[model samples]
Target chain A: MSRASNHQALLAFLDTIRRPDVAAIDLGEHENLVDSGLIDSLAVLQIVLFLETEFGISFAATGVDPGRLYTVSSILDLIDEFG
Target chain B: MFVNLDVGVLHEPLSGRRWEPARLRLEVERRAAHYRQQQLAPGDRVFIGYGNCLEFFADLLSVWQLGATAVPVDARLTPFEIETLVRVARPRLFLHQGELEPSLAPIFEACNVSPLDTDAVPQSEAQVPVSSFTLDDDALILFTSGTTGDPKGVVHTHRSLRARWIALQQALGLESYRRTLCLLPTHFGHGLICNCLYPWLSGQELFILPPFSPQVIMRLGALIDEHEITFMSSVPSVWRLALKTARAPQKGSLKRIACGSAPLTAHLWEQIQAWGGTSEVLNTYGITETGSWVAGTTGGPFEAEDGLIGEPWGAVVAIMKSDDTAIPPGYGEPCATGETGFVWLNTPALMKGYLNRDDLTARAVSQGWFMTGDLGYLDAQGRLHLRGRTREEINKGGMKVYPADIDAVVERFAATRDMCCFGFDDPLYGQNVGVALVLEDTSADTLRELHAWMKHHLAAHQLPVKWYLLDAIPRTSRGKINRDSVAEACAAHEPVDLANMLGAGR
Candidate 1:
């Protein structure tokens, strides 16, 4: 559970679902969160339903690569290769 | 006139080869002899901006086999919406395929650029001449997904796109052994004229997909049984995210399933009829000034109703009155037979206007119908229904409401997964109700139990006096709902105690 606390618990769940005057920056764990608009395409389906309900994990049973769920160090290497 | 179909690329994440229909008509006649070696005349225009490959359908069939026009755009627009569409489509060729948004380099150096590359695919053997340009010329421009404003363009012609591919081959009987499965975005008209030019002019078999990710629509039941895919069309948010992560397709390899640009929630049309074990799900209706799908729903099993849509086909629909007139056909005019108003239409596959806006083509056409800023009704068994968008209705103090009846009571809230319901600037109701949402639990006790189930199924000027939550519900790259950015994120949020959560739900 520690990649700096999974990047501070994924930037505190993307600053509690972003856009309320955005602000919470520091994203670079290999940046690109959806080509830099910092998350979209429905926040990549709310980060795959927040890693299947906050880390029970299962991006279709870990065969991950939906383009490495678009960055923050490839979603912390897909939650350390599928949580 | 020559597109005898058989194109099959299936998974082109930037050229992973695989095309055939005689190498996609010899790469569309060597890109129509490089648009007749750049003299590009026969009614010019061009633009394209490619993306979902096969070299964006061979530069849109070599700019409609050189009778020219083909505008296309939307490679996720914005370099100020491609410099307001190259300052309103003054294109004599912009033909892009990659890299040209360094703020559109002086609008691609004032037009005439061309590089739509797949390694320039033209190994000669050129027979280029065929377009003496008739079918009254113009041939396709498309745009309008400017979610309730600005993006205009529209146009069409080549005899209103062969009367919308002969009204979708006489209302969806489209043959040539069907195949289909294209996955939207061919710069809209429901993915370039109903999923890729009416299945490439009804000589069918196209597979395409790539670029539409809910992990590529939860891998549509293994790409519809490895492309045996018999017919599909999208947008009901990609069949409600492929009925929540795909997987149900093995009964007779899915014979049909449509669901047009928006309206279709009868619980996602009965979960896309039990996940395409087929009742041929249809439920369409049209726009982009009437060309794409001029009304649908038929092919049996039915029950979803809320602007049900069902009957127009070659088109005529009416109901009018927001001053463009019509509403008089029978049972007492206030929009007779079943009541709602403003839908219109009249189609021979409409549109040949709006490009240079003649004041929005005289307020969206009049003497020959086409008003369609939507809001609908027809019924007493004539079928039409739709009831939202005449600028997203919701008047509050004068009472009008319809945000698809508060998105069918906030999509029956099992923690709501998407929703919009707009109309915001209310100085005591000149326009009020707001809404936003997109939750499966934005937890604050799941938004105070969805504001106590939308104050027990709405009606206090149809509730929602602003409430945003939103982790998504922005849309419009033709999945619609960008209701002016969900009424500017429900008028920049800040109304969340919801009167102590509707007085603690009574």
Candidate 2:
């Protein structure tokens, strides 16, 4: 998958679960969903689960830094690298 | 009676500078009048919170005097959760004595409601008038354990609450205990009764800690020494941290260190006793249903055994088979004669019912007994030994598994520091065990080593199927693990591609 496709995938995945009315959830903009409260500690775990099943990928202890999962763009970059 | 809260009772007041019983009556009456002026009324639910210890206590009786229910809430809940609770309870008034206004302002806005703006400062001299309210009048609505979800409101009448208070007073001979420090939040049953009401009823002084801290506990020892302190009540976690970081209370000043809320392990209990100086570290058991602690040790302070929750105090306890029928005489849950089973509290303090949840209320209480979902067998002697929660038990390939049992063993591993063991959905077993752990060291190979270490102590089905190592586990403001969020974390699946479906953000 291309970089744009991976980014699109991440946005689509977030949309599936995120409440429709959440503001400032622009996947392309912010990199840290947690610090911004767009997503919380709970959301971070959901993102991990999403990455594993969608791409048939797994996260090892050292495979990815959690900071990489902060925003859709950073996550897309990570997914593209793995893909 | 002059109440000294810094230390447990130095002397049971045989006779001292006494406030005449008539004078105490006048004090209550005075508070009642103040609440009436504030327009508080019967059936109105008031959420009592703030950093000021005095305001939290005085406003309680004041609200009650004005015929309102004082619903104490932990100020620690996330704004979202707090907003949800406020909506559910629809408290007529919110009395907060701290700088939470900026945070609560947006929540109140979202709900399309305006909070009553009060002076940002707190008054120490606020007093209320005395009024005679029926024992059956709803006095408080404490929340249930949040292990499942945002805690539900458990309504309690004044009579029921008083019954619990009196029972605790009688059981512990609380007249003798003064000079208290409270680490528990004032919102829940245990914290409210033990720290707030108990001190008030005994006319003792209570210094409320803003939050639990190891540094604060160290200072507590010094304060006890400085003030000649006596009694303290804390949860197991607070005591554990104190043992690790601080010296015990001064030898002669402190009397008892009480631990409750979660199961107290034997090793942890002994460590607390050793470190708490001569003061006995007492294990206590109570719930919102019981109003306050119902069963505990009566001996000096420490239990003869580590994990045993003493005997049932003026409460009837039983162990039943899976069918809810009492286990036959020969084969009962292994509690001491008075101990075991779900640890039912037959006190008058059982909640009137869950607020707006008749179905849940019916399910929780039956046959004049509240069903505590805890699993334990009474010993032949009647002492209760809690194995942990029956509801929290995990099922693997038809084998029943207790997460606490496994967690206790796994936590003993040198590599593991703090852990939360729970079950997630699995196609094979319906629900398989999984664990999210914070390691003593965050190493690349830590997860691999943990998986191996768990292998020796746990069975195949009992072992954690998936391991997620965290820098820190998510905990509620009170520092208990947020199981619902953790379970949600476990159920979360990896993201699926979206390009084929909807377009990007509009």
Candidate 3:
């Protein structure tokens, strides 16, 4: 999938898991999901699940870099590199 | 300095800070002398507002040295919530490392309590006070609930705490705990009383981490392997993250791992065993009132089974038919083997009672046996198993968030006409907070104001993650809130569009 498509898919998945009081799409591309109050600490687990299921990104084999998953920009970069 | 405290080496792996026994003792003495200068005495309650570091332990021992009860406050609490507890506990000294929250200053002023800086200690290593404390005096008061209401602090005497440590030592030896890591918060009973203290106070090296930080959890295996941690205890949610994102520890130094305070399924239990490279992941059974861990899967050899609690460590586990505490010496006949009933525990390690709340204590304890609000049964093989809890608190992962506490805060808000907080099934946390609201106005302005009120009075974790708007909350015939029915009703309807609603107001 294209990087733009991956970003769209990731944003959709985040909207489902983000806190009810916050809009995931409203967050900046460089904004940290947790630090920016878009999601809870545990909600990161759902993001990991979304990566494996949708994009076939396996953290176990590639090793997780928390920074790569913290922001929309970093996540798109990760998809471009791994996907 | 006296050496009977049994405190071992304390380390913070994230910061790479370590305090040896001699250095720890000196730190404790300096802080103890500082407290003495501030006129801290026996029977006084000293609140430590921060934790998960070396200084926190020093302050704990220092408070004990002065015969004062240590109250470890959750720093996340809003100033309003903290003041509510301050009014109840009536602490003599509020110990924090640095500046108090700007809003918290007035509370100390009105309450006439001193906020002592732990870092600003006496220069000399003061000798232990003469006749400072006894084993029967209150050692710690860990608050379980009622942060925004009447806070219920579980008071454990030094004797009871020692009983817990001794009992744990007798049941679960200290060899495997030679190097232990704790990721749970120190304000919690399971974290302070068992996971941190049981091993650390038994003269073992303790490695502490900031509680529930995904960054730290992401590198959990590396932290464990670097420290060569032999034993660690955490909730299943943590294991869920570790098993997925973090690389498995390669050193194979894990002698045992324990998951408690939340339900651990057989699938997840086995997953933890594999990820940690050890088969000793025991699903521990404990509560704040019982001084944390009372029972776990420590009986001989056993396969991981759903709800299997194994056996008691230093307590007599009984499954009873009746939990009518209104009657004197409240207890009933024991259930037949393999029959589910109220799980009652008789332990020396049970908390003295709720701090200064005998009315609440009376409702929970009867005779010598404390009626645990848990429902479970014993197998023919003489093992205890947990089925469910009858308590009103929402178990968000391992952290117990009381529903009434949230309701108490929300009800006080002008925009909230009626509110009911309940637990909903969550994939990551096992259960998360859900609120059913009957608001005075459904307009975005009122909704935003209500959200602002909640954020001010409640911790982020305690705030309802899911919200439902209703005409009125469904209630029982007698007008009591049935959380389950309200939860069921809310599940049927779509939740309020809080993000859009608040955004519209903005």
- The best candidate by TM-score is 3
> What is the TM-score of candidate 2?
0.60
Q: Estimate each model's TM-score.
A: 0.31, 0.60, 0.95
The true-versus-predicted C-alpha distance at residue B475 of model 3, in Å, is 2.1
lDDT of 2 by residue, B294-377 (tens): 777664344546567777766777666442424422344433454344555566777898887887777777766777877776
Per-residue lDDT of candidate 1, residues B102-166 (tens digit): 76776667654543444554686467557657777788887663311244678988788778778
Q: Give the TM-score of candidate 1.
A: 0.31
As for DockQ, the candidate ahead, 1 or 2, is 1
Predicted candidate 2: what Cα RMSD to the true structure?
A: 15.5
Q: What is candidate 1's local distance difference test score?
A: 0.67
Question: DockQ (Cα-based) per candidate?
Answer: 0.04, 0.02, 0.49
Q: Which ten residues in a row have the lowest lDDT in candidate 2 chain B?
A: B1-10
What ranges in model 3 sit over 4 Å off?
Answer: A13-43, A60-63, A81-83, B1-3, B122-128, B326-331
Q: Which candidate is the best by DockQ?
A: 3
The models' CA-based lDDT, in order, is 0.67, 0.60, 0.86
